[model samples]
Every structure is written in structure tokens, then in C-alpha cells.
Target: MKPDIRGRQPANRRQKGAAAEEAAAQHLIQNGYRILDRNWRCRTGELDIVAEKDSVLVIVEVRSRSGSSNFGTPSESVDRRKMQQVRSTAEHYLHVKKQYGRPIRFDVIAVMLNAELTTASIEHIPNAF
Candidate 1:
């Protein structure tokens, strides 16, 4: 099996993550954010979603949880370490794309999927950190 960046992930988990990201992207679009990139990679890490609205560049982190919320909400999963990684990656992205001197914001999108993966609940938190 081909392993992902974090290591080998079960097919179902990967699929669910992909679905969640897609839903997040769609939600952003629906809310008038223009998507700049998805799954952007750098030496630091990957940016789940990069978008822009009213000339402000937005860095979005997407987290997904299935079934119960026993472990906690998906947004709570993005701790300091993960935020640092996202920030580092966003810096690399700005440098590489020459998007300097622009306003920036960090956002977290939590997606909760039902057990059958037929429906999802999305929560968007702007200026998350």
C-alpha cells in the first residue's frame, strides 16, 4: 500500500478525510471565498485549504471526525504543534507565491460525518489562532 505523508493510512480514513476537505472547500466557496489552493505542500507540511476573500489571504485547516464526539470536537484536534506547522507552511507558500504584504487569517473547519458517511456537519471558525 502506498503510504501518505504522515505514514500509512487506512483507505477508509483517507477517503473520509478527502470527503471532509471537499465539503470544507465547497462551504468556503459558498461563502464567497476564492480558493487559491488545496493540499499545498512544502518542506514543512501541507496546507489543507488556501483561500482569499476581500483581498485577505486565508489559511484553513480542515479536521474530520466520524461517529461519536467522545474524543472531542474536530476543531479541538488542531493543537499548537499543528498550528505551528500550518503557519510554517503558510509562510513557505507566501514566499513561493510572492504573496507578500497582504492581510492573512487562520481558520479551522471542523467536519463531523455520520457513521455511514452520508451526511456531515460543518463548523467554520475564523481567526482561529
Candidate 2:
């Protein structure tokens, strides 16, 4: 059973996802990353997170799974179709927002959690795609 987020907060799955995302964002900020955009979207798809670290345009995909990477973690979940969508999303972000113009790379932020929904570890694979 999931914990109740009432009497002080929300009480649903979506709210929990938001909470997890926020926590992950904080972790990134603490590691010297500047948050560029969160939940950036286009007609094609959405990038979970976007940040800049050391003058590099980092397109981040946040995947929260309820276990370890033993069988298959979140980062490994970015299949070929997903990669294509990410590429398109990155292109759109570059042209439309005009924020990231040079020196860009794709990254995956795999967030693993325990059965109780507590964060176990965050694996960051830079230049993954």
C-alpha cells in the first residue's frame, strides 16, 4: 500500500511522481548543475528534465522504477523508439527555445527506488545517446 499524502499534501500516484522528480532535481542542483527546463515538451514527446553542466546542453530523461537494475533499470528502458523521440525533442528544444545551440549531449537519469518508494540511488549516464 502507498503512503497517504493527505492532511499535508496530495494523495495520488501523480503527486508522488512529482515529488520524486522534485527530489531528483534538487540532487542535480547540489551537484553543480543548472536547471534549464523541466518537463519540456513538443508535438512529438517530452523530455523529463533539461540542465546545463559545464557548458554542455544536457537532455535528461528521468525514469523511476520500483527496484534495482538487476533485471532492467530505468536507464536501460530508453529503447530505440525512445531515442528517436528524444532526438526529435532535443532538436525542437534547440530550434524553438534557442537555449541549447552548441555542445550538446543526451543523458539518462535512472532513479531507482525501494519497495517502500524511497530512493535507492540515482544513476547518471552522460552522453548516453
Candidate 3:
């Protein structure tokens, strides 16, 4: 499972993810994306970050890989099942609010971490699976 970054996160890849998310959030803010929620969850799944950009619902997925020793690339880990869950969660969110007129998309935020789990780099892949 991924670490929670909404709260007090340790100084590791966990926080790296948070940093990437923070950067992405700022980018969105500057690019006119209004943040709706962060790390929202339900009984079925969770959405890492949710926001409204250009009148569209965005479901963000943040992934962190420490040196790629075992887990390969961060973006590569977000397989089909995870995307399905994100889509499902987005649908659930819309269903709960009865809002279904806006377009929805999936975004991937990849945070590269050093061997010690520190921040290496951040890559934001919008509309990525």
C-alpha cells in the first residue's frame, strides 16, 4: 500500500509523493485547476487527488519509486486494475453528488526517489493511465 501524505508524513518517499502532489497541485492552481479534494476514499477504492480543471473532473494518481531497484518505474506500476478503480471512484464521487455533465480524465504523477527515499524528480503525466 502507498503511504498517506495528507497528514504528517515522514521524510522519505512518502513525503516525496506529497511533494510531487504539492507541486502538481500548484501547477494546477496556476493553470486554473480548482482543487476539490485530496486523498478521498470509500469502501471500494481511493482517489489520490481530485480537482476540477477546465470544467472537467481530474483523478490524479501519485506513484513513487525509490531508485527502481525492484518496483521498476513509477508510472509503469499503475496497471489497468488501478485505473479501473480510479474510474470507479470517480463515478462514485459523481454519483454521490449527482453531477454528471463534466468530462473526467485520469492523470499520473510520478515521483522518483533516491535510494534513501529522498526526492529525485517529479514527472506529471496528464491523461495517463
Candidate lDDT scores, in order, read 0.92, 0.79, 0.77
RMSD of each: 5.8, 3.9, 5.9
> What does candidate 1 score on TM?
0.90
State each candidate's clash count.
0, 0, 0
Best by lDDT: 1
lDDT of 3 by residue, 11-73 (tens): 664566676677667667877889898878887798888888778888888887665548578
Count residue pairs with overlapping backbones in model 3: 0
Q: Against the correct fold, how does model 2 do in TM-score?
A: 0.80
Would you list the rank order by lDDT, best first? 1, 2, 3
lDDT for position 39 in model 2: 89
Report the poorest 10 consecutive residues by lDDT, candidate 1.
2-11
Model 2 local distance difference test score: 0.79
User: What TM-score do all the candidates reach, one by one?
Assistant: 0.90, 0.80, 0.75
What lDDT, from 0 to 1, does candidate 3 have?
Answer: 0.77
